[model samples]
Target: MSAVAPVRRRRPGRARRHRQRHGYLFIALPMLLFAVFTVLPIAMAFVLSFTDYSVIGETNWTALGNYTRIFHDPYFTTALVNTVVYTLMYVPLGIAVALGAAMLLNRRVRAVKIYRTMFYIPVISSTVATATIWYWLLNPQYGLLNVFLGWFGIDGPAWLHDSTWAMPAIVMMAVWAGFGTNMMIYLAGLKAVPRELYEAARLDGANAWQAFRHVTLPQLRRTTFFVSTLLIISAFQVFDQAYVLTKGGPGNSTITLVYYIYNKGFGKLEMGYASAISFVLAAIILVFAIVNARAVDRENR
Candidate 1:
């Protein structure tokens, strides 16, 4: 019989080195694009935030002046408050509604695919179109929503007109438009949960609520964290709906951080001040995201 030759295995150290080199190739394009579009812009904005640049021309460095003005500016304070209120209203509501919708779809209901498609339609629709439609729907005199309320002997207030109602109206529209995508995400998370856990919960005399609380929710924690983080950031950056529906009107009730930034950058041509505000928004988002990550990491442990 012929002697068989021993097969040589690749060394782990060499293999790891190859993998590390290959990793850079895969990541190079994305890193390049991010540096160009995201990192470089952020750096530029940070530098500009300390200056007195405008559409006219660069004047001189006014270190911390823009940030100092932010503290004293009543409009900035109001915008910050409005943005916070909007985030509070929209984020929780969106997550709850999306979770509810996702749970419904998780059941073996008829036409589930169609239902998911219907729910997701609003998310993919153009924001401008959605805002325009919602604007008409919330109109005081001739809106469908008011007509329906009138039928039930309830007076519907001017939704986007009165300052008290304007922000809430925008919040409602935002939730409707935003939740569907998160619902799909939650649905995917739900699907990954083990059916055996539900069976075990039932065997232990657990009710539907108990099964969900014990098994489903625990499994969905990561997804919840991701969705909440995204929604919170988006809520802080809301601008298009306000621009189209209320124009930050009804006494600046719907003005948000992003709207304020747009007014400073484009309307007033104060790029440096706008950059300062943008950095503040970035800081807020970063703090929240860090908190969320830590909370999720603790839960995972």
Candidate 2:
């Protein structure tokens, strides 16, 4: 009578299945939208990259001809080089400005929110509007930038008009417009850094610079990596500023990969070739991202 049969707990298979069904239903709309908008377009572009698929006329397969043509295309080469140069200049400067701004604002000083807002205003401003303002500022004559230069008896270059200065001008504008967001990111990272670490550093006779170099920077490695990766991608894909300011002009000195792709796809109606070049650009961005991720991982280890 005391030896009762052992009871086994039954699995909630039906309830679990019901919950999973709801989860799928909840995500169905977003999944469908992503598939239709992102996945399908990428697939179509890849397929079209293998063909002579201009918007008009008959389409025909061209195999790897489109890819091959990119290597020999002078405009493409120039655009690629310009894009690389822009990325090289933009990423470092953007990081420096953002980090410096973040460090400045991380203090317990009064009116810090006002300063943060002022810095972030440009990030929220429309790209077209920002570029327009910069356009006026960089004008060869009567612009504020050159006017200030003249106060010191310094002659200013024709920024957007001069081939030598056009890309640098774009880089400057982009950095000004973009660094605010990264500054906010850095601000968040700085906030997350344990205050105890700084106190510890102080107790160890470390000065402000030493604490920043050893503790602050080390703690913010992940944040720096994330910010750098984003900056690299955005810098590589730069187009709107160049389009609005110079229209890839001054002898193509300001032409970028995205600008070149736009000219090929829409301006020239060479969609297939443009798609091929775009895939190449995608490959380059992917490589940089992977390298950056690996570097972060190595540092963490």
Candidate 3:
């Protein structure tokens, strides 16, 4: 009988080390960029929050003065209140419209791809373009929105100009511009749902609403959680729309927190106060994110 030769395994030697070195080299650029752009700015902002940092002037340490001032600043209070109100309006409406659109898109129809593309067009459009178009559409006197409302004999409020209606109008515009993305997300989640579940639901004599509530919603809990989280974060960081459309309004009624931060930072050049407020905003967002994640996790369990 011939002697059998045993196979030898490859050792972790120079070749493996060479590959590892190459991999590290590939990642080094991205890591360096992240450190410079993201980490460095975050660190600077945190430190600046405790100092009176003016862009082109002498600085003095303020310790917690900026933070303390936040509590007493009526502008901050108003901005905070407006932000909360915007959140309340934006979150629910955004979810509802997105889900409703998603459900509609989930159907098997001819030209469905075209419909999907049309829905997603707004997402790809520039924020500036969207604001400009909406600015024209919201012209209370000659705008198409009011013109349409006139057909029903409803007196449309001066949308962006009216303090009472300005925020809601902006919310309406944002929802239209943004919901397509969540709809696409929901559509994906809907696709992943097992067909057997829906078939089983129907066999049990469940109607459409019943099936949606029991089968659909349960399967989509994770998706809903994700969508709601994005909406909340976006709602908190809302600036561009208010900036372009209302400019925080006739009475500061639409003055959102981020807008206030922008005004302080660059408008009034109160960099330290802005930095402090921004940190507080970050903290608030963190708390909300934690609560959202925990609530969903508990329910999933």
Candidate 4:
């Protein structure tokens, strides 16, 4: 009779439930912070975009006035054009430089870590500090770049001061400062590529260029897409270099959407207009992101 006593089976569901509870507990703080800081601010900005809510005085509802004014605003139009131009130049050039650097570093060379560190140093450097150094280096008179050009019998332009050269100069500094990051990303992508592909290409009588074109490029498509998307987004938001170096100067040659937003919001105390412009910028970014996602999905399929 004692041996006939039934043994109760423990439920596996209980352990899963306990684990789920603990997981939620672990993530609760981060979720709270995100909701409070990120989500709340965004929601507030959206609401503020419809009102004449300058930092001073009573707020008044403006409906679509702020959004409507953006269309006729010459400064906004100029900023938009400048942003697009910067993007066109920066993205392709940035990707090329990064890919080239990555390829160079991908070799089994001595002191590779040192080289990597040297390239990455600029990325970790303070933006203000880098801008200051670049300011000195780009000075029309006695700047290192112009001095080197002088030795080569090529006269250098006033990079920051000249309207024609301001954007290009900013782009150059941006590419130099930014490509290192994308280079690291590309290096990681290059490392992840199956070595068998290269070997197979060689067996098929492919040369170095042929192997890279057929084997390497195809394998790195996802990486390229990711890098390009990031570059596009960052290019659209470009402000610091223009602000620090040119102040959107030489008749607003380098003024970007973000710099315009800054001037509108803080400089002119037009918070509602600034908020509207920000949302417009956000919409543009969303559209690009969606397009990139669709392209990736189509490629994957």
Candidate 5:
């Protein structure tokens, strides 16, 4: 034993160790808060999804009963379908509108700052107020929308009241309220695009439209993907507009997954079912997010 000596691993210097500690200290509060607020709630919800914990009622373990019941739930099916439709409508339109706004704003025109402020105002305004405004504007009989439609001799249908048109009405309002944020994101992306690309395109006799299609679109691919993912996520979680404008009314046409979850958890006190639906929605969102990411990545390849 006296002839053998163990070699210890070297340790980091005091300054290096102190810097690492400081770095961890900087992140500790955020990680702690995330665990407490986000991770804990998700874990609690996952557990509750397997049990019949109806808030005030006796808690009972049902295994996969809630999840199994989801397949048979008509409301869930309708809500899921409605959510998909909303996402489909919103994601493309939102991207287009945001991109268009970004392009227009990128122009070095006079008073462009004021135009930006006006566009961004809705993004910061109260959702309730925005919904209220849209509600007024969408009035079939007394609304500005109908008035404008009537100018073209095209009678706008009862927007929020008509089941067929309700979801679309919601989509329009959401796009209007949200495109501002996406516009700013796209504006940043546009700014980052190399001016040399535009110059090369111009040198090659590319017009504005051609330049946009070839240079701008290709350059903003990543930004578009980011915006699409955000739009997809937000579209699936759409609750405020539907709840405010229609309350999932007009025969549940506007009933989103989140709205359905709220109705179950609060309205019917079916916390277990709500949690199960929430998890299902989370899964669906994950799938869509993955698909979009892969789709964009594939294009890159």
Candidate 6:
């Protein structure tokens, strides 16, 4: 009986513990870089928002002045309205087009890769270059768009030159430049969908449209959620296209929140005000992301 002592199992060795620590060490550099480039700047901007920093004088803390002014500023209000309208128009249309393209390309057809490459060209292309090209394309007198409109006996609006049509023009340009990425994303989503589900749907007498509605849509729900959320954020933060095309004109009709921030920071030297506006933009984007997440989760359930 005295010889029946139990042997205890030891914990993980020093080597295993060291490996875990080393794995975390590899991530440390990237985390530090992100903090430096992203986190620090956001914090600095938020602090600067409540101040009266200008090129003419030293930065002085002015509690709630910039934010209160934002509420009262007619130009900011106009930009806010324009941004919301642009997001509403762009997000739905972008998703529809991307999903359509993805479905078309998801088939077991020839030359699909080539089509994907062609579609994605605009997404990879530089925004400045694309904007410049579209600037001429939307030109009133001699642009290609108007030339096409002539076939239908429709006169094209002055895209960048007129206040009335400028925001619409921006939306169109953004959709063209941005939709390719989402299309590619959707293609990947479609590929991940199981073939058995489609076969089952077909055997159940579901047509192509019906199959897509019941099977494809459910499978791609996550992708749509991601794509829509990203597109909403990007659409809201739209700046370069408007800047390059209209320079926030004809009479500031195309002046979005980001463009306004740029003007405040660079043009007016109102860095504090610009920072406040930036934080507002961040809040809007966060809310949109949360709403999209909840919608997607509900669909999954």
Clash number for every model? 0, 0, 0, 0, 0, 0
- RMSD for all candidates, in order, please: 4.4, 1.9, 3.0, 3.0, 3.3, 2.1
Tens digit of per-residue lDDT, candidate 1, span 117-144: 9999999999999988998899899998
lDDT tens per residue, model 4, 71-120? 99999999999999999999999999999999999999999999999998
Which ranges of candidate 3 are over 4 A from the true structure?
Answer: 1-11
Cα lDDT for residue 282, candidate 4: 93
Specify the highest-TM-score model's number: 3
TM for every model, in the order presented, reads: 0.88, 0.94, 0.95, 0.92, 0.93, 0.92
2 or 4: which has the higher TM-score? Answer: 2
Global fold similarity of model 4 (TM-score):
0.92
In order, candidate lDDTs are 0.92, 0.96, 0.94, 0.94, 0.96, 0.90
- Candidate 3 local lDDT, 1-301, one digit each (tens): 9989898997899989999999999999999999999999999999999999989889999999999999999999999999989999999999999999999989889998899999999888988999999988999899999999999999988999888899999999899999999999999999999999999999999999999999999999999999999999999999989998989987999999999999999999999999999999999988888999999999999
Query: What TM-score quantifies how close candidate 3 is to the native fold?
Result: 0.95
Query: Stretches of candidate 1 above 4 Å error?
Result: 1-29, 295-301
lDDT of 5: 0.96
Q: Which stretches of candidate 5 lie over 4 Å from their true place?
A: 1-20
What residue pairs are clashing in model 4?
none
Q: Report the C-alpha displacement of residue 255, candidate 6, in angstroms.
A: 1.0
The Cα error of candidate 1 at residue 225, in Å, is 1.3
With a 3 Å backbone cut-off (N, CA, C), the pairs that clash in candidate 5 are none
lDDT of candidate 2 at residue 180, scale 0 to 100: 94
